[model samples]
Target: MADTVADLLIDRLIDWGVDTVFGLPGDGINGLFESLRRRQDRIKLVQVRHEEAAALAACGYAKFTRRLGVCLATSGPGGLHLVNGLYDAKSDGQPVLAITGHTYHDLIGTRYQQDVDLERVLGDVAAYSERVMSASHVCNVVDEAVKTAIARRTVAHITVPKDIQDWPSSGPRSKANVARHSGDLYADAMPLPPQSALQKAADLLNSGSRVAILAGRGCLTARKELLAVAEKLGAPIVKALLGKAVVPDDHPLTTGGIGLLGTAPSQEVLEGCDRLLIAGSSFPYLEFYPRPNQARAVQIDLDPSRIGLRYPVEIGLTGHCWDVLRGLLPLIEDKSDRSFLTQAQQRMAQWNELMETRATRNDLPMKPQVVARTLNEFLQDDAVICCDTGTVTTWAARHILIRGAMEFSASGTLATMGNGLAYSIGAAVAFPGRQVVCFAGDGGLTMLMGELATIAKYRLPVKVIVIKNNQLGMIKWEQLAFEGNPQYGVQLQPIDFAGVARACGVPGWHLADPRLARGVLKEAFDQPGPALVEAEVDPNEPPLPGKLTTDQAWQFVKALAKGQPDRWDIIRTVVENKIREVV
Candidate 1:
């Protein structure tokens, strides 16, 4: 077969060990699509309903596999649709490669059909963006794009003109491109910090009796070392949402997630600690962090700019999570005191008990917490779960316990809707053998409802659990949290997501009664292919934060006093639920 530009790029992708490509077929890239078809055996192109989903899938694939995920789209609007998902990957520091199509080379600035500048379009979201001028530049551009994405842990963009894609390849393939890097290629290898930095961290930790560790996604690979450092310091650990599963939820020292979607115990641990160790996380919520001078901090991260960006730090140790923690463990003194850990454990236990009570309630309108707990009961040790950003995030954070080898992913920084199903599809494609699940709110699920067809088409066994509250639950809560206002524009008509899933050729179940949740969820999980379970939940049940300030309390009371039909009933139910926490 003659070597076309598409052939060169496809061959390079194969050489880079990319076995799959998430993309959509469009008129702008008919030539590229033809080449994809020719090389279909080597690289499977996952056809998605929309270009946005394609980009999100690539992000999801990279997040789970720790490799450079690849996605393709046609010119103009197709490339434009990829911006949101690319931003999600870029914001969260995931490595991804985006290939977009453009018009013929001669029509570059003629105002022809689909002739937008691809470089400028993706410039903000991509660390490396380039256009293929000739067949000779194919290998170098594609190779460098992939390399830069891996080395910098960011997105790389390549736009190939429709005509150029059909040209024969004559580009040079460097030895660097052929040689594969061992271990984790997604993240650049970072060296340990200086001895003085490690010693300073150790000194601060030893001097403070109450030490706390805030672990994030960067600590994913350093679980053992992170735990070792925590144990040596006699500290309780608080997790950033992205780092929720860094250490299992049930770990004695763990207080679950901190900040808005966090537990009470995690807040207590943060407020009570005298020394804070931030490992591999740039948790953006400054209010959730301890005030300056209240607790001294030592931040360990690979990026120097990010070291003290999130919180005020006395010492910044720029290095990999494992390297910094491993180096500091030897220098740190083991603390004999256990009061801090003991108090944290007690508070966590109380919080856990309250959560269990709420989650186990077989109330008429099913509790969303129960949906997560029931799903958790049926999940495998190696299950991969993707959560949408909203109220469902709260349920997943508090109810789902990360145990064994489970992998949890979400839109951490971007926090976009319509990502749950797309992410699950990518995870399913990346690890077909592993069980995949998506926890989404009704609002989010409806936004990308078309992905159900993709799931069914591929026979990807992704179980979707939609928390059908018939409203934008998170936004509704936000209004109450920020100001005492009656809900507006947040109400959603109840949706039959299960029926929609069935229409897409995926089996589904709708659970209105909480009593049937366990059995129906199990049945859905047992299905050999894609399945969706929509559980109607209490819309008024607020997702309370770990701590409520005086102003927030006032806002809540004012919102109730505005006199909606069920305002008093909602207040009563909320008070009753709070009373259960103490009783």
Candidate 2:
């Protein structure tokens, strides 16, 4: 049924239900591209501007769809460019397959053009890496790569030499006796914890009155189970950033996000609770969690290594979130005392009030919080929000309320800067009818600005809101907060992002006035095609944590005393923003 090794590989991918692939073609991968061209009706390649975006788009597609994402690239630098995005996939535990080309078989060891050893280069980021040595090896290698990626929830790589890709697809020699593989592999069934382990976890959760639940990305599909457990325990749900959409913010028991970009209510509950249940989250900040001896904890995770990673747990149950929660629900007793849940809800209300006050502030350069809040007001009920890493993350985490069927994600563990636009592209392609929005900082947007052309060419209805602060806002604050140092080398030159978007054949708007934000955002979202909005926000605004530590306070003072730029403005802005909460 196949003509060549490349054709066989493509056919196998199609058999696995892969309809879309993100890639950029080059000479090294011409053989594979030719096969793709011939099989155009079976599968479609979504050409991207850069190979890095291709990989990131694949990661995004996987995160949103819960399916295997595939990306392709040529040899040498093209393959090297995929490393950052592949690491993003690896760190975030997304299933992705990366296909790359290599130099001719004979010239690989020699210093031939584009003869870099990609297998070794991608070794650290990929869970499985292989190079097809023969035409008969292509099908087996591709099958293995796909199986490994999906089963392990990690990145997998396959490299095909240029000459090998064009060779005829042949069966193994009769005497050689090489094993053949099938393409019918599917995701493994959801695992359930042992009944004894589930009972122990349930007993621990039932014993405490002040129970708190920490949810993360793994809880995405287990929302119903998570809420049922929370209701039974009378617990408050504090979400990690990646799990923002697991439970709606409007839910009475939801205490909002945890850690630096988290909410005040989340901090209060985590600090004050007597018992904690971590469901499918490996939140890294130990300080944000309860003191080791203060609370008895139970953890449920799909990975055994992550069970007690962030907290000391009385019981560690290794299983899928949905399965474990279902197993534990029947054994759990409904908590009669509603005191803890009521207190958490009250705190969440006060936090919401404080956020409103901050968002309404009429600062001259426009507070980024205002931009995020305004965008939230205009977001579709089921919109997909992709945010970049920076101060933009703070605004999105704190202001954007994920409700209905909304989905949200970013470079959570990897914290990469340039993934917002590429992620939005992937979301747009995956669900063409849904509203997809990207919140990007000026620095992050500039890193992969070339993708605007890709969006325009596809005419996707994605809305890009660039928070134009003209600086690396997050790094600037981290310098002062973590190191007690003045900001240096963080400033960025202002650019007319809207102009660039227009040049790329997309509608664009530039808004500097806070009063015009809502109108401009509505216009941008109303556009049938992709659009960009450049909202100039204040650079001096600090992204304060949910609860300021004494050490962080001292660091802020030390940096100010050491001649931090805009010292007076920073002081004024911080005081103005926090004054109400303090009162």
Candidate 3:
């Protein structure tokens, strides 16, 4: 019989194909930590400086390796710190397992010293959240949670109650769980829409004065087929940020992407279109959207719940994106209109060129845009880039130049920080030989730095490039743009990330010349063990989070003086510059 709860967990994890667990050890989790010490081969645990880094590392693992990522945290505040990272796994559709310890069963409802309601806390951010209510539930729940995480491509939360975790499971635990058989959970698909509905949609697409298609994350499965449909209809497709990779960027029918902070050309084209075919997307921004009376809309989706969620739909077809699109393609008469696609491309090129020009301007401490562009040139196509949330996200979106070679992973929906480090850990573990580069901010790194130890323990070759800007950049930018508050809590004293990595046993390097970045990046990837590459960066820089106007800033100042700023007042700012968000 296994002597400890840690042994039981290790046994289950081995069956789940998890060779490594990225995290730190602490007092609250001492029992499990000790158990891990007993069997170092099956489950190699990574100890990092912060929980956020562990989660970020896990995010990378799931995205690059096409496998479930796992991260561990202790009870109370230790576990609470993983919320940002867990949300990253949730919103980005990464299969991640978040296992956290809970205070002993004896402390239930007694206001235990280190207890937080983890189940409820993880509920909104996780696809599945459950507590090991009893030791009997452990083996089954663990297996099932891992399956659901992979099958659903979302994060699963499993809280291990402290006491029973160490309690024997009554017999030798088996490797299989009821969940191992969870394959293609959805069996019966929604029936096809009526013939009249398809005909009406066909007729509308054929006769509409202006036509376009908007695709979202829901279209991931139907991507290639939908691309065919768009081409046949002469429809220019606009993608939600989450739908960025659905239709290959090189496809001619691809017009531009949509949302707040989205491209100006895309928004203009969408506004001008008379008929908009919504495909697999429930894009959140509604105000920029025209009145229902403006565009005749038709939507096709697998989930009936999304049929009419965003805007009113003329035809709400409850079917998979590809299946519905296949029928729609045959009915859609080819049109010669290339005006929308052309106009958008022209604008995209002009703006893209303009931004590219500004990104390379040499300045002291180095502009992040310059770093992003320069790094992209050196990184191989197979490299995986995990960017932190901050001004760096904006720079990366504009400069990283995703040409299909690299798979980009970031917290798109939750827009959380501290994911750069944690997600990279997972990415490295998932693809041991592939290059994993984490673009992190100093502030974001501190939140998950403890994962450095995790990297050392596992000896996973994950390289982190810390953009050492001494501030909570996104918050500072927000305060400067909207609040007009002289950066308050946003300022941070810089920490030598390279020094920290050395202290943790991972080799470290500090580089200022981007020309040298290529060499250093190559060496790090070639290095047999984990490494950290810290680059000093400018902090006053901004991702320009949700742009605001001068007028809005003045109003916010007055509101601060007057003690109140309404919602519309804040919206006014985000509208002016129109920031584009990339997931």
- Cα lDDT, model 2, residue 353: 90
Candidate 1 lands at a TM-score of: 0.96
Give the winner by TM-score: 1 or 3.
Answer: 1
Over 4 Å off, model 1: 170-189, 563-566
- Per-model TM-score, in order, reads 0.96, 0.98, 0.78
Model 3 residue 426 lDDT score: 70
Please list the C-alpha lDDT of all candidates, in the order they appear: 0.88, 0.91, 0.70
Residue 517 miss distance in model 3 (angstroms): 6.2
Q: Which portions of model 2 show Cα errors greater than 4 Å?
A: 171-180, 580-583
lDDT, candidate 3, residue 332?
A: 88
Sort by lDDT, best first: 2, 1, 3
Best by lDDT: 2
Name the best candidate (by TM-score). 2
Model 1, range 324-351, lDDT digits (tens) per residue? 8899989989899989999999999988
Error of 2 at 575 (Å): 2.3
lDDT per residue for candidate 2 within 1-583, as digits (tens), equals: 6888888889889988898899999888998899999988989899999999999999999999989999999999889999999999999999999999999999998999999999999998998999988767777788888999998999999999998888888745445535564556675767888898888888888999899999999999999999999999999999999999999988998999999999989999999999999988888878899987999999988888898899999899888899889889999999999899999999889889988988887768898989999998888889999999999999999999999999999998889999999999889999999999999999999999999999999998889999998999999999999889999999999899999999999899999899998899989988888999999999988898988899999998999999997999899988866685587
TM-score comparison, 1 vs 2, better candidate: 2
Model 3 residue-pair collision total:
37
